[model samples]
Target: MKIKKAFPPKIHNPETVNFNEPPAKLLERLYSSHMPRSYKKVVNGKEFFSKLDPNIAYQKCPKLKELLDKMLNLAKKSQSTAT
Candidate 1:
């Protein structure tokens, strides 16, 4: 006798992401994503940390705004699905 292979459950609506968390937390997670580069520089015996500005990122990467919008939508959707 051959045993059947088990498969993961299929998602009903793949377009809508369900993070199972609050909108604030979801937005924080999206912001923490590696969209901007962070750098550390030491000058005149002083260390400074610089991060890519959102405006610059938007200008440099056209898809940046689109991605951010998608994440924002996901965060909003998560708010409704949050446990």
Candidate 2:
């Protein structure tokens, strides 16, 4: 996973991120990540409060809710069919 570096290099420490807060634009721009750089303490040895909580993201960005719901539904369908 690539550490997303902004023009000034944003998160040097994951603990600095404000979780369950900030706006949609901020979420996408700063914290819209599947990479575990923030979450995996094995890599950084710091506790990072979640900014990518799906509920928070959905509340901030309705579009993300819709997209995630669709993806979840598709995954469920695929899993059921596989079974």
Candidate maximizing lDDT:
2
Question: Cα lDDT of model 1 overall?
Answer: 0.46
Clashing pairs in 1: none
For residue 19, give model 2's deviation from the true position in Å: 24
Q: List candidate 2 stretches off by more than 4 Å.
A: 1-51
lDDT of 1 at 74: 99
lDDT per residue (tens digit) for residues 1-83 in model 2: 24334324543433245566543345344443645433334333222233335575565555677798899999999999999
Worst 10 residues of 2 by lDDT: 42-51
TM-score for each model: 0.33, 0.38
What lDDT tens digits, residue by residue, belong to model 1 across residues 2-79? 101121244343344467854334434443453253222243113211432567555555467789889999999999
lDDT of each: 0.46, 0.51
What does candidate 1 score on TM?
0.33
**Roughly what TM-score does model 2 have, to 2 decimal places?**
0.38
